[model samples]
Target: MVVLSRRIRSEDWKPVGVSELEVNALQVVRSVDNRSVIAGPGAGKTELLAQRAAYLLQTGASPAPRRILAISFKRDAATNLAARVRQRCHRIHAERFDSMTFDAFAKGLIDRFGQALPERWRPRSDYEIMFPGDRDYREFLSRQIGVPPAHIGTYADIQAISVKTFERRHLVGTPLPLDGWLQPTPAQWAAGCYWQRFLHEGKKSFLSFSMIGRLAELLLRVNPMVQDALRLTYSHLFMDEFQDTTPIQYELVRTIFLGANTVTTAVGDNKQQIMRWAMAMDDPFSAFDGDFGATRTPLYNNYRSSPELVRIQHILAQALDVQAVAPVSKTVGTIAGASCAIWDFSTPGVEAAHLAAFVAAEIKAQALSPRDFVLLVRQKASEYATVLEPAFVAAGIPMRNEAGMVGAIMLQDLLVEAVSKLIVNVLRLAMATRAGRHWTTCQEALTALVGIAHDDEIAQAKFANELDAYVVTLKATYPNSPKSKVASRAIVEDILRFVGREKVVAAHPAYGQGGWLDEVLDSVAGHLLASSCNHTEWSSALDVYEGIHAVPLMTIHKSKGLEYHSVIFVGLDDGAWWSFANDQIEATAGFFVAFTRAKQRVVFTYCSHRGARTNIATLYQLLTNAGVKKVKIA
Candidate 1:
């Protein structure tokens, strides 16, 4: 075994505070063997993972030019880890490290081995990977499964079943058993039938995201050269959020480098494995057991939360049947008036109003920014929109919800019309420039660019006459060449000025700072400069920029791997959280995950009645038993 302290300088590799548990985990990372790190919440697992990558690069454990592959369950996680590694390691060696999500890794393998795939799996010339859309495909499945379109549940379910079948390594012609995770419902049976046809149609049709993983597994198994190349390319593999990994994902990793020279590290909290319904395995530790001989390392330190928060997490972990290791916290003193509280309301609407007011009061009292707070719910739906948005508006609080951003960008008619017209005019300008048309006046183009109707001759002539003089001045100041950077800048500035950028920003403060409009303009100008302006590209750019900060509101599932200074977990009634399962394990795990998201304080809200039933007895008992204090809202 190699000791990292001896191999590397103290200044180069720090974070050593004489803790036995952290020492064990760090040793495991520096070792040249397989290891499984069972890191509980707030254990600094991400920092540990980032350090491991740095160690491998700095200590020459992984030679230069040979990469270390770090896989994360989420894109943000991967990106953050890569950034951390770059900051810690030397630039020359840090460039050898690569990080990506599992789906992205699978897609890369598929692209490399597309020609070597079996005929049935081989894609046609125009075949593209389609997402879980395409109503025609779902209708085709409905006909085959002897069900109507409405009864097909969702394309998501079909994709899940298909991925699960491949994970189990079931043969092509085998009937997907109705036992285990798959129930014998009409929808399940339909999914099973659709899974088979989904494979058959892979040649000419689009492949779902799940199919990418299955294909990568197949390609690796059938092509030994690709397997060897991959094994040699990466010297170390570090996977974050290992507990959330599906079985197929584990198998894919195992097939590529299990018996090879590559050392692997899997880090996650088994207690937070709440994604079992999405095909995450019940026992993630089994991935490291037998054949691999992985060393187990546990990290129990709670560095992010107060001592009070750590105590609550310990109690909840015990209730959920997860192995409870009391978190060691250095923050001995709790914040004044920061104790956990459960708020009960007479009505959902009233609850929303109270929540908005409470958040405003907390922000002022703590002198915290709006970004420091997060509102988490079990589900985001019409109820959230109706109750929360108006209440926040009435309270003069800024709030942003992920669903709202997506809807505003994708559904708003005015924004959509403006973006579409911009794309069209950009494309037309590119074509005219390519054809060497020198006499095209900017005034006539701007008239069409604004989407003015050709039949409205009076309005067109009026605008064209006003802008004709301006065009002469613009031509003198800026070159007429399409590819010139100066020309692109002038066009973007003039269009933004004409489109009332100031008015747009002033009207929609929810879009965040002034930079958002600039981002939109830059995206449009980049596309126009490249002569690649299309509706899809332009809409995607708008969607990306529309995600600027307001105040993050998301479901608990989406809130995983995220933390805030103050957290409000709303809609904690029976139907929303516990209704997802008959057994209490999943619900308990979910609540545990939600509770640990708070760094300083947590507020759990529940209504007296949700749609018809009173508050759930089980939930009330769990909270009271866990020692949560009941608080009255003014």
Candidate 2:
């Protein structure tokens, strides 16, 4: 092995911060074999991965010169893991940990080494990216003359077809079946036509995340040198949110290290797998067993919830699976009364007043802030906000619906998040005259990029000088201009131009070269930049942007992997969760995820007699079984 080791200590093995992990977690962390850690809510999955990374790096347990590669489903998740590692280990050892999203990893490989891909499948280096919603796919499906939706399947099914395997063998069945997915000759030819134009364009091919994944797979298959290099570079693979692994993601992982010498640890909870379709497997844990020879380790300590709250979660878990064992709560109760309760309301106004009273009492008695409480719904947080915001307003409580627009465009677009962070960082330095924390922060950011070399002093110095000059140019260009959409777009454009687009895209691989960036630029309006502040001083604006100043409200899907001191599940009645009948398992999983989001308390609020005296009978039964008291709000 080439001489490079960030090993901080000799062979002395013990976890560095956080000693609450049990024997099972410790075993999973230190085990050299492939493992699948499937545990319920708040079982310390992220903490376990961090400790494992620390063990490998500090103890020199892993093969020398190889790095630890962590692939998460979200960018924040990747960043969070990287941050935790940095907190737990030395800087040099932490530098050996590479964390990124699945999309970013795939896109990076293709961007750097796609020349080796097969000629027909290789995308142009200048390929653009597309993020299509149902409306776009609907228009495409409508144009087909005789194919029928049954032949090609729905837009959702068509969207699932991999660009890497769009051949007739994968699409068409022998006799052209009447129903189900991709069986007719017309469907096969039609899909091939779409993907062909999508993949091999004359001017510039259009690539989606799926197209990027397939191309990355093709590149790996064609280039042994690249595959060998990757295998040699990374000996440990830590996959977070493994239950949400999609088909393309699964195949790509298998393509890289199916039978390779890498130690892979996947950590997730099946009860929290609320994401749909493209997730691709019936049981990913079992799939992991068959493919990677992984040992399944289940963690049972409920470190997040109180005993009463865990009991409620257990009731729902039992309803979903008869053999489910309840996780023992490791936390002390914070509330003196019932930790889990249901409130029955006859009117919205009275219900609002009652909640305000309860919140005030709780704040006085327990010293909890508004941020400690969260309002969760099965779906449509914005619609519920229309009915509930008046309550918060009447009480002088600040509440925000996360599903509401962030900027002017898509709710949580990747490009918007990346570009926003970039501008904010640059602005921070632009506002700073000398080199201190600002320069260090910007330098750390540049070094942390996947494409940047931490050891390259010359490149680092050159980029640092460029950043200083860019800061100068930015202030000169704007010079105390009021924040507006036009000004925001121009500022963003100037920053992108000065720092270079390729550099930013390299930092954020999923910020694909497309009209989406232009759309995001258009949406970077004054409201988002200033947000609850009078001007563009960074700290004042970031307070609202980071959810520090308001009460939290969001859908259950968005609330996954998040925790609060108090969680209120709104709309327990049947109408709000009408789609539960379509898929009961998924519904139960969603409810389980929502209930476990509290460390001390969970309040289920229902307007039982407001409209039609409606209730979800199954949910009520579970609540009754869990011994939750129903309090009437008058």
Give each prediction's root-mean-square deviation over alpha carbons. 13.7, 5.6
TM-score per candidate, in order?
0.70, 0.84
- Looking at model 1, residue 327 earns an lDDT score of 74
Per-residue accuracy of model 1 over 1-634 as CA lDDT, tens digit each = 1223234653466533233336666686577888888887888787787677767776778876689999977665676677676556654565677888887787777765756876656544334555553454444543444532455455455444343333233322222232312443434455445555655564554555466676777778878899999888999999888888876677788888878988888898888887776667778777575557788878878777788888888887887654577878755544687568888788888888888887788778878777778888887544576678788868877566643432223211222333434434433333332423422433333554465654688997777665545544544544333455455556767655654554434333312232434555554455444432221243233322232233567777767787888888887776675464454677677888888888888898877667422445565566677688887654
User: How good is model 2 by TM-score?
Assistant: 0.84
Off by over 4 Å in 1: 1-12, 15-21, 131-142, 145-204, 332-334, 405-549, 609-616
Model 2 residue 265 CA deviation (Å) reads 0.6
Instruction: Report how far residue 515 has shifted in candidate 2, in Å.
Output: 3.7
In model 2, which runs have C-alpha deviations exceeding 4 angstroms? 1-10, 133-138, 145-186, 200-204, 407-416, 425-443, 447-481, 490-501, 525-527, 530-538, 608-615
Compared with the true structure, model 1 gives a TM-score of 0.70
Best by lDDT: 2
